[model samples]
Target chain A: MTEEIIIAGFGGQGVLSMGKILAYSGIMQDEEVSWMPSYGPEMRGGTANVMVILSSERISSPYLKVFDTAIILNQQSLDKFQDSVKPGGVLLYDPNGITIHPTRTDIEIFQIEGNKLAVDMGNAKISNMIVLGAFLKIKPIVKLDNVIAGLKKSLPDRYHHLIPLNREAITKGMNNLKPFLVAEMILK
Target chain B: MAELKLMKGNEALAEATIRAGADAYFGYPITPQTEVIEYLMEQQPEKRTGMIVLQAESELAAINMVYGAASTGKKVMTSSSSPGISLKQEGISYMAGAELPGVIVNVVRGGPGLGTIQPSQADYFQSVKGGGHGDYKLYVLAPASVQEMSDFVEDAFDIAFKYRAPVLILSDGIIGQMMEKVYLKDQKPRMTNDEIIEKYGNWATTGKKGRERNIITSLDLQSEKMEKRVHRLMKKYKQMEAEDLRFEKIACDDADYLIVAYGSSARISQKAVELARKKGIKVGLLRPITLFPFPKKALFDLANQVKGILSVELNAGQMVEDVRLSVEHKVPVEHFGRTGGIIHTPEEILEALEQKIINNGSIRHHKTRESSIL
Candidate 1:
């Protein structure tokens, strides 16, 4: 099975790093993966996005017309990529700044309160991990142990001590997810 | 087994540089390829393997530095993009004329001038057609994936030293910027100056010791002497064409149509080939890994089998010229390209294959439906 995902948010929100971590987790689980970031104009605090694919077989196109999952963090990304989520796919977003809620009835939509949770945890940088935690809780593509291992592998040695804090944020985000009004399916 | 790590194509190339036992890398920073020098600087190969990694003032200085290191019979490399590579033409021509061995990488961006920093294959004509002025041919290797970006570094050095000529790893921006899993080469110690002199010093510019002065010059004042040097260069290029051609044919054994592509275009065309196969169109892909060798024999053989061919690239049809030359117009060779850093999707290529090559005549009936009804 192949899972094509798009992680989009503000540039400094660790959008690219989030995708990189998931790709590393795929490697940790012995799966093939690819990570492609939108590296042109969005690199300077604008809306940033990255395409990530994890598959049991070799991945062909790193750029996809439609994605199985879209983790959106801002209103711009929500407006841009709301229609790009495939039917019966998952669209996870944090409701920190998104004004217009997604209205599609074909896919599963979840509003994850990662920003509030990060503020509550007194660390604002691990919000991406919280969204990642929500993604893992909703669709268990990779194990939590593998994700921790991926963090250990991806993070530099100086950032090693922050792994436990990031793990806590992920657990908090996983526990505090709010699904849409009508849920037809819960992938797990 | 070698360790597998996730790396960008440029980063993998840099890591592979240290692992390949190359003695020196002199590079200038350019978009989509700055990561190569960044990784090399971070690694500090000077401390690890006694290799030198110096950031030059410009691409010209970098290439000339590569030439100087290579003149001493040391394995050397430099990386750049399309515009920067243009500035390196003079140095490249000199090194090639002098027959120095080195590797040059062009993570090509779109161009006729200072083009976009995004991925583009517009350098196809410039690279395979000999960008520098001379009768010299540089072995050009096109890498489609990040893994090849890592592995081809070794192959480029080996081929360069074997023929005592410059080799180019011609990759586009997509492969350079995109990240993928790659297996790195095993670390090998950098060759000392004495080792280089003893092993490859026959024509090298190492000090003339225990022998007459070994001159490494490309200048011949007399026209007749220059013609003789040209003949030797031509002869060596001919030998390389005979032995070093490499191409990959996928699903072409029993196919009706063929898609000729290299590097990133090849990757997309492979997907298109599969999609066409599912539709029972019998399409296939022919990817040329070595562009200079041109894979003329393989294309000619396939031309005898396939009804038509579609050459897909990210440029405005450069390699298509080589394709037509290879098949000698045996089949209808069509070109599909997106210039100025525009990359066509797989669906677009598949549509072109269907419209321009497959279903236009052989796969579709051109007879009037009304006449058949009448």
Candidate 2:
């Protein structure tokens, strides 16, 4: 199985790192993976996106137009990538700064209070991990153990102490994800 | 055992240089390729293997430094984006003319002038057909993946020293910026100065003790001697073409439509070929790994089997001309591309194949188009 995922948000939101962690996890499981990012000026302060692919077979295109899952963090990303999700695919987002939510009917839309959970955990940096946890809850493409191993591999040794907190954030995100009722929101 | 690590292509290439036992890396940082220098700086290969990494003030300085280091029979390299690469053309020409061995990497971006920081293959003509002045050729290798990006460093150096010619690693921002799992080979120890003198002593200026002094210069005022030098260079190029042409064919045996591409474009076209095959369109992909000794003979041979060929690139249409020339108007040849950093999608490629080759079965030759334009 091949999983093409796009993770988009502000540069500081750990968008690129989240994708890196997922890719590392794929590697831990002995799977082929590729991570291509929208680099340059946008990576400084503006929106940043990374295309992460995990495949049982060889991955063809590193840059993709459509995705099996889109883990969007900000409103701008939601606007840009909502239509890019494949039909029956998953669109997981953090209900933080998003004003315009995804309105897709064919795909599954799930929202996790990633920002709030991260703040409550005393580190807003773990917000991406929360969203990643919610993604795992929806589709466990990679094992949790591998993700923890991935965290160890991706994070520098100095940040090793915070792995438990990040792990906690992931668990919190997994439990708190709520399916968004698009029709009800439209009616309101 | 080889160490397996997940690394960005640029980072992987940088680390490979150290493992390849390179003597020095001199480069000015540029977007999409700066990570190469950054990784090298962070790794501090000087501590581990005594490999020197210096940030030159400019691309010109970096390339000249490569020239100086290479002249001493040292393994030297420099990398840059499209515009910066353009700046180093004069130095590159000097290296080529002087028959100095070095590796020059161009992590190509959209261009004519500082076009975009995003990936592009627009430098095809510039790279394959001599970017610098003179009739010299740089052995060009276009790596399609991160693994190739890492692996080609040693390969480039080997070819460079073997032929005493510069080798170009023609990459793009996509390959440079993307991350993938790469198995890095074990570290090889750098050759000692004595070893260098022993190996390249005849040609290299390792100081004159008992032997005649070696002079390194591209200048020969006598026109007859200059022509002979150029002829000798041409012979080396011809030798490279005959011996070192490398390419890959994907599902070409039963294919009716063919796609010829290299570097990042080739990687994307691989997907397009798969997509077309899924839709019952018999398509194949020919990826040229060596751009200078470009898979001309391969394309010429494949032309006989395939009904039509489409050259895909990030440029408007550059390699298509080469494809057309190789096939000798054997069948219809078309170019489908996106410019200024826009990478074409697989679906769009399939659509182009359908419209340009499958449905519109016309044997449109380059000469005809050129004459028509004239």
Candidate 3:
């Protein structure tokens, strides 16, 4: 199966990093993957977005007008990409930052308090990891151990101390997402 | 050969250059093409193999530095995207006039004036025909896959040195950004500086000596000598046409409709061909791997066999003129494409083929009638 996801937010919000982590996870899973970013002036302070496509077979076009999933970290990003989600697809939103509710009934929306969960875990910047943890809950395509391994491979040896905190953030975020998923399943 | 590893196209290009015995890489950072410079910087091939890597002040300076390096018979290269490539045209012309061997990579982006930061095949004419002033031609190689991206660098460098001309890898943003598996080759041994001087010491400007006075200049004041020099360049081009024409033909023997495309557009066109076949149409693709010295003979042969030809590209009708020239009124040639960074979908191309080929209406009739009457 092929999964196409878009991770979008304001610059410095780790949107690109989240996309990279997913791409790395795909690589670990032995799936063909591509991570493409929006170039030019848009990368400065404007919307920074990346498209990550993971497939079992060869991928055709890297440019997608409609994405199967969108991980939005801010209200602007949610407003920007809500309309582009494919029918019956998934939309993961950081509830702490995003105030705008999705208007589409065709998509399944999951809201996580990513920033609050990360702050409670001691590293507020680990909001990206929190969202990733929620991603793992919704779509268990890659093992949590594989993600930890991917993160370890990406981080420098000098920054190894941060690994434990990151792991904690992920665990805490995953624990916080269970109630929501069960409720969503019951609603469905 | 080694195990295949997932790698970006620019990284593969850099790795391939090192394997191809490249001695120098000079370039500036540009979108889509920056990874090439980044890979070279991170790999630091020079400390291991004595290669030269320099981030020049501008694309102009980078190409001129390449000119200086190539004059000494060293395998030198530089890379950039559209606007930067436009800046390097003057240096490219100078290199052509002096008959130097070098490799250039153009990871093209949308353009006319910074049109977009997306992939584009609009630089077809700029790279195939001479973008730089003066009568010149670059041996342009278009690679569709990441594997081809790595493999073609060696071929481009070999052909450049064989004919004493510049070779260009014409790539787009998609190829630059996309990752795919590539098999890295074992490093090739390269010639030392002394060895290069010993071989091409006649014209290289290393330094002035008592007996070795090497001169490297493109200026030729004498009209007859300049004319003779141009003729020599033309002769080299003709030789390349005979020896270095590379293309791929897919199920084209009895193809009623021929789709002429290259690079990323060709990849999409291949899918279009499959869709056309499912609908009971005998469609095939003619993908030109080498854009310059364009596979005219292949198209000419196919023209007599195919009922119609469709030129597909990411840009609006750029390479279509060349396809038209090759067919030369023997068959109807139609063009379908998108511009300003929009990628053409396989469904859109199939739709055009259906209207122009399967339908085979007034357009084909008019062409056939005119040809018979003539």
- Worst-scoring 10-residue span by lDDT in model 2 chain B: B361-370
List A-chain TM-scores for all predictions.
0.95, 0.98, 0.89
Tens digit of per-residue lDDT, candidate 2, span B1-374: 99999999999999999999999999999998999999999999999999999999999999999999988889999999999999999999999999999999999998889899988999999998888999898899999999999999999998998899999999999999999999999999998868766665568776778878888888989999999999999999999999988999999999988999888888888999998988899999999999889888889999889878999999999999999999897778999999988889887888898999888735445436646878
Docking quality of model 3: it rates as acceptable
State the lDDT of candidate 3 residue by residue for B38-111, as single tens digits. 99999898876878899999999999999999988889999999999999999999999998989999999998
Model 1 regions more than 4 Å off? A181-188, B197-201, B361-374
Better of 1 and 2 by DockQ: 2
DockQ, in order, for the candidates? 0.62, 0.84, 0.28
The C-alpha RMSD in Å for every predicted model, in order, reads 4.0, 2.7, 3.9
Per-residue lDDT tens digits for candidate 1, residues B5-49, read: 999999999999999998999999999789999999999999989
Ranking by TM-score: 2, 1, 3
Report how far residue A62 has shifted in candidate 1, in Å.
2.1
Candidate with best DockQ: 2
- Candidate whose lDDT is highest: 2
- Candidate 1 vs 3: which has more TM-score: 1
State each model's CA lDDT, in order. Answer: 0.88, 0.92, 0.83
Q: What is the C-alpha interface RMSD of model 2?
A: 0.8
For the predicted complex of model 1, DockQ is 0.62
